[model samples]
Target: MGSDALSPEVAARERTLDDLRRRMASVPGRGESATGHIPREQPLRRDLLPVPGPLAELLPDGGLPKGAVVAYSGAHSMLSGLLAAVTGDGGHAAVVGLPRLGLLAAAEMGAQLSRLAVIADPGPDPAEVAAVLLDGLDLVVLGLGDLAVPPARCRVLAARARNRGATLVVAGGTWTNPSLRLDTRVTGYRGLGAGRGRLRSVCLDVRVSAKAGPPRHGRIDLCAQAGRTEWLAREAETREVVDLREAVS
Candidate 1:
């Protein structure tokens, strides 16, 4: 049963799988026991993956649920935050089909780039690549682009993630019945003075919807200053207005 005796197509598939395993093994903090082979009855706390500070407060599970599919919409900053949170917490992650993803922003957000694998162009079927990555990575972010994945395929990918004890995050296109959904919108920007001052922060209105229960909503602020990105609490609606004449006096 040597590989030399197998057909060309079979050999190629085997080689591809081997390469994937090698790459997965090379990721930092990927020990033998952490390669999605833990027993279901184990007492390990693998139920959820860590999310950013503000986002964790919004989720019912306090983090992204393992073995589930989550659909995200709106700003790409949210996706960067997810990647930064997961990878920064010593978990391996993969990004597929997000060619324009800002790695610098993720780094500023505290992501460990060494533990992240980015597949900017995942061939014709990015879903297939994501499915494969779920076998090893703790989180897989799949950019659907313009492809409308069929319901059956979506179900299959979700099942694969569940069986592998990984999380799949889908962006763009349409996903059928995701376990959770996050929608974010930029409400406003801070540090502007009559369109003359540099931007200092962004305000995001985030909504979290689950398969059951009422949806939760929150506002978050992303402050970029001093070469770091900080997630701050929601700003208050009421603020003290200072008159220009009084301030000048």
Candidate 2:
């Protein structure tokens, strides 16, 4: 029977049932309905950003912790590889003031160009530009480029990121108090010989030192070969990475 034709008491009961159903559907993580999902606004816990399996160990939390600032110095290829996990999985990423950024290489590393933005140069006040992007971007990659960011400004950005659950990654430089710092050095290059072949891959020796965690060191591979595999793998097959991490720690 139509709701208009029902008795008042029966109609009230039906309305209550409908209201209960709506409340149940809106309960986050319970289940989704056809209309749309009602997200949890006040969850006690938050989740980290997705990271590639091989690079997961680099982060203390096994994933890129939201609201953390990481500094990547002299690790262009590694930065690109890391960004691929974010941009490829429908996350928005921004690159500012890194004119020499290998965009083609970033794609080869698996980043979805459609979801990435590159400012190349942001004029004199790049930090100000970054502040604006922090409002909406999932990740903001800023190029240091000799511009010195004051301590107070850095703190403000860090606080903002924490509040917004976004990551602030500074590349090609360092900051006053970065949550993590990685120094990358090219230990060797492979798949090339005597000025006769193209560069295929690089072996990087990275020393990971963090302000909030213990220090560790490891080797990571950045390969441009066809069907590239894990970018970070242990040099010794017999020794596990976790064991090496413990040894280094």
Candidate 3:
């Protein structure tokens, strides 16, 4: 197999192999092989994003995992809070097909307005929009509105999220095989007494359940002031009950 005696085809194959090795060696990493496909740690190194104070306790790591597929119903404010939590960290968030989603409310709750995108009323279909957003954003909230999204569509979006390492949050519709399921309702209100008082806190009955765990219910009081939001703890027994009633005029 001397080079001088090698056939033309054999010599060409050798040249191609050498070129491939050279290219692989030029790539960065701590691997031994020339093209050691690099360790899985590179992508997994992205740390999980922290959730809002009120909902942090509900998640397993007290933070949202990348590539998570979540389905939520009930209180719209809760959905907005989750968006703010992700967008607060400089991560981009896309709200697809939600014509009535309150952008100002999310802004007041800590979301960076610059990182938020609203694709309201996304034509007759939003699956394409969601897919495209998933490729570029860290968080994509797909609003199915009153229409029931098909299982196939959910699976497709879920696959896309997994491939892109983006969190997929579904609202106004149901989904199958969701990594997390959230049910929230406005059970009461706080920081107001009469119909003329200023609005303060909103009491939410949040039920959180994951694919591997049982459902858990808890009460959370969220207060927004001066365009900022925080979780409000209940008063002690000795203190007078500051009734959390809604302010209406």
What are the RMSD figures for all models against the true structure?
Answer: 6.8, 15.9, 13.7
Q: lDDT score, residue 245, model 3?
A: 44
Name the top lDDT candidate. 1
Best by TM-score: 1
Question: Residue-wise lDDT of candidate 1 within 139-237, one digit each (tens)?
Answer: 999999878899999899999999988999999989999999999987777666454466677778899999889999998888898988998768577
Clashes of each: 0, 0, 2
- Tell me how candidate 3 scores on lDDT: 0.69
State, as a TM-score between 0 and 1, how close model 2 is to the true structure.
Answer: 0.72
Name every residue pair that clashes in candidate 2: none
> What is each predicted model's overall lDDT from 0 to 1?
0.81, 0.67, 0.69
What is the per-residue lDDT of model 2 for residues 56-97, given as tens digits with 9 covering 90 to 100? Answer: 676676666678888878857777776786776556677877
What is the descending TM-score order?
1, 3, 2
Selected candidate, larger TM-score, 2 vs 3: 3
1 or 3, greater by TM-score: 1
Q: What's the residue-level lDDT of 86 in candidate 3?
A: 68
Better structure of 1 and 2 per lDDT: 1
